[model samples]
Target: MRSAALSCPFALTRLFSLLAHDQQLRAYMPAQVLLNESVERVGELDVPLCGQLPNDWSTWGFVVNGIVTTIFVCLGIVGNLYHVRTLGKHSNSRLTRYLRVLCIWDVTLLTCTFGFYGFVVISTGYKPWYGDITYLYMVFYPLCQVSWTGSMFVVTAISAERYLAIARPFRKLLSEARSVTKICLLLLVAVMLINLPTFFELTQVSCYDEETNREERMIWLSSLRLNKTYMLIYRIIIYPLTVNFIPFITIVFLTIKTISVRRSAISRSQNTQSLSPSLPAKQDSGTTAVLTALIVKFLLCYSMPTILYVFEYSENEELNSRLIDISNFLIVFHSATNWLIFWRWNVNKSSRSLTQSFIFTKEEAARLTYLWANTRPTEVGRDLLYTLIRANRSLALIFANNPPNQTAVKQPRDNATTNGHLCDCRLSESSRSPACEHNIQLLAKVDSHGVIVGIFCDRIIQRLSSKLEQQAIIDEIRALGRIHYSNRVPMRNTDWMLAKQYLIAKLVKDECDIDAEDIRIVNKFASFLIHEVKCGRTCAIAAEASVAYGFYPSSAYTHA
Candidate 1:
């Protein structure tokens, strides 16, 4: 071999690249020839490219991502499914309906992106056949985008609805069901339109390095240049910041005000209505607490990841791979967290009942109207929650500074007890951990249905009374007397609307054979009671106080 190598140094040079022995040369020669022969042969090489790479998830970092996201996704799916079922099983409530649908949208998104996609990726790590573009575009991106965008719209709609309720106060506007349906339809359309560009631009292409002459393995992403600026606006500014963040902020403001108002009302009112043992008080503070927690947590979940993604895409260099993984994980993680946080922060049977009982109800609107009417014309209306929070903070500071007398006066027990027992400041067994027991008890006592009716009636009467009182009541009656009051045709769904005519009709139905004249007198007297007993004190106190208040009357009052 040395003699032959000396004879041809060029051959020896070539031999160094391979083994010297014929048997060894044959083994190396085939592979070398195969590699050099054509790009096609190189591409077809049996050697594993992706397989040779270390398992990413098996490492501590990816494993944590997998576990946490999996747990969150599972919980979210279960929680949202329960909420949807609850909505379907119960009679429709405007607030409940809105929240229910929102939850469902979130769940669907989570299932696709987190549950399905995540499962596939985790199970088949570094596997070649695992990541296909067709599946990503048709199934993953659309589903995720739709859910996310729809959720944003839903949040916005909820805020807008609340704003209308708070601002208008007295208007007998659209039905909750109708309004919610319309909003949902709008959400669908908006999401569809926003994601339209995604469908066109989301095709998967295999990334190839032509110079290397090997099969490209990674997925190639392409986005349309047209109106990218606008799309960014929608995704970054409008969708996240405007649609989600703004509404969330508005709710927070409102929630704080509401808290302050309720506290003020509680302090001022002599007879505070106790929530049904099972229900939250009418002007419950928990609602604000929950809303605030939700907004804060949601912003935290999405904010950093979104910022990272923006930075990642803005530059052309390879980002820290860890950051990429983290950002991706955050997207799915948020979906899971939304469900858990919502339930955790704002859940109790009583709160649910209260939400159903008043949100979009005629009574609620009337109360809101009464609040507005009571509000001095000189002052601008504000979110009740915002005022409530300010009041609470002020009170907290006042109490904190004025340390109670150092005398061993027993701390007033904040917690209620079971077995008719009382303890020092500690919550009773039932009321410990979750503060839902009191609300539950309250819901049980109230005839939520009749309450709804009276609420609607009170609003109508208040409006009529305000108008009638503005002009002399006698004059108004005389005007009615002079008119040829022909029997009016009853409107359809008069059941839903508690109009004056409908109320009289209902009175007749209840008190069979009672003279219409007596019924009229009773109605007038009832109206007086609502004005005097139900709202008179409230109006007086509200007019006097330049602050927000929540007035909860006794729950034991019979529906008149």
Candidate 2:
């Protein structure tokens, strides 16, 4: 139930100690403490955040500076800790290394702050060590400066890396393991050096402690901070640039350029896919949607604080203090909520134990599908569409060999196509490698299967209409996807149930009714076939991204 304002006891005791030494204070006892109309700061300032506010601000300060801040900073500490642990589990790639560094410093920042404010100050009404030594010279102030500097620059570095890789994939700087390690080390050391001056800015000075009733050491601004030239070079120029402006501008520019470059990259990939379907589709692009979303979050959370530092400074003490408090809250909130962003968007990516994640139920599938539908319509949906178009191509060739008016489920008994389904023979042992491509190439009529993709596109358009048939069409797609996926799963009892749940989500996103679902069903069936047919699980990604899955050899899918 303690107020957060008490956390500034170092600043408060210093201020009142100066008053106790004043010539007017020697005139009386306890009465003189109240008789004084105003108390002015005698010497150098201790902390920027500690200062006076109006008498009416007590309740507001307690809620903001004390309780809410403590809670959020505590949350931030936990979030960053978990983030570090999670990222640490992944293999040491260039991207994962950068992410790990970002998480480590974020933990350092949040933990130090929480220790200082959330625990020490609120619990004991003072700093952790006697004479205010720890608060003044040790933990929170110094760590926060270096950690913050590290976070800002790390983000900028990551942005630059992503943009560079996309804009110039051949660049060797961030591509190699050793180079990434070197960059991470240089970034850490450079940030520490940038904030090195903060340690010398404050020093301990002797002052009378009213509560202890004796002389005690308290924090005060050091002579170095008072130097005019150092202030200009340090706070006015270097601090603003290193802390906010430089990183902010660089990230913004890089993010915009990245978006532009990525659009062109996708276009280039499409052209490449058409010209040479032999190539693996959509190779690693050196960036992820998760990082993009994180960058967006950083922009949203840090703008007000960074803006206030540069263009919006106010001379009024109370107003300025309030603004700083709000900015601090914004920062802590940013650190806390990023975990939600990470786990929400990226839960599927963890390569942890399959037993933990593979228990996919109907509800879980629905949720996963819904997320895919909403967040990645173009990326995920297009991936599904490509495979189906490829499947339709293969399916058309098989049916061409059959007599007219023959159903897909019925055995034609004329060619190798009808052992089970379009992909059944392929998923079995016979056509596993070299992919029957030598024979299929002679029968492939690209024009005959071309219209199938357009028919799928029409179903996506029907999503906007109110026709009752659309639902029925959607239901059929779900039913087919279930059967299609189950067809490759060796007839497990749970396969049908698992497939049905995800179908509900895919159906809801329909613009066209049947073809979209059919496309997704075929893609799912094809990808599943890859897993069951001994190509391994990694090939599922390639099967989803590329068409002509049957054209590639088993070795290609395994590498994919």
Sliding window of 10 residues with minimal summed lDDT for model 1: 1-10
- Show model 2 residue runs off by greater than 4 Å: 1-57, 124-138, 172-174, 209-213, 267-287, 347-560
1-560, model 2: which lDDT tens digit per residue? 11112232111111122233434322221221221232333356322212122244445555665678688777767776787777647544456667767777777766665655555445544333235534634456666667777877888888987788678753322144446678988988888888788777656555443344454454444667545567667766787777778888889999999989988877754522321221122123323566788888888888876665545334454555566567666666776676666666553354222212223344433433443344333333333332342333333333354443465334334345432233322322344334334435322332223344334434433341334443444444444344444333232223322333333345445544544444444333322322233223224433443444333333333232
Model 2 scores a C-alpha lDDT of: 0.50
Q: Would you list the clashing residue pairs of candidate 2?
A: 459-511, 459-512, 459-513, 460-511, 460-512, 461-511, 461-512, 462-511, 463-511
Instruction: Give the TM-scores of the predictions, in the order they appear.
Output: 0.47, 0.54
Off by over 4 Å in 1: 1-58, 126-134, 162-168, 172-175, 206-218, 223-283, 309-320, 323-334, 337-348, 351-560
- Candidate 1, residues 1-560, lDDT tens digits: the string is 11111111001112222223444333322122222233333444542221122233345334644566567778778888877776445445455677787788878777765533456445554212213422543456555656766765676566555444444422312233445787688778877886665455333433333445455443222344123454445444564554345545665665555456645655654232221211234334555455556555555655654454233232221233344445546655665666665566544453333323322234433433443343322112111111221222221121122343442222334444321111111222343334334333322222232244344334434544353343333233223222211212111221112222333344444444656454444344333322223222323333323123332322211111
Each prediction's whole-model lDDT (CA): 0.42, 0.50
The TM-score of predicted model 2 comes to: 0.54
Cα error, candidate 1, residue 20 (Å): 53
Which candidate leads in TM-score? 2
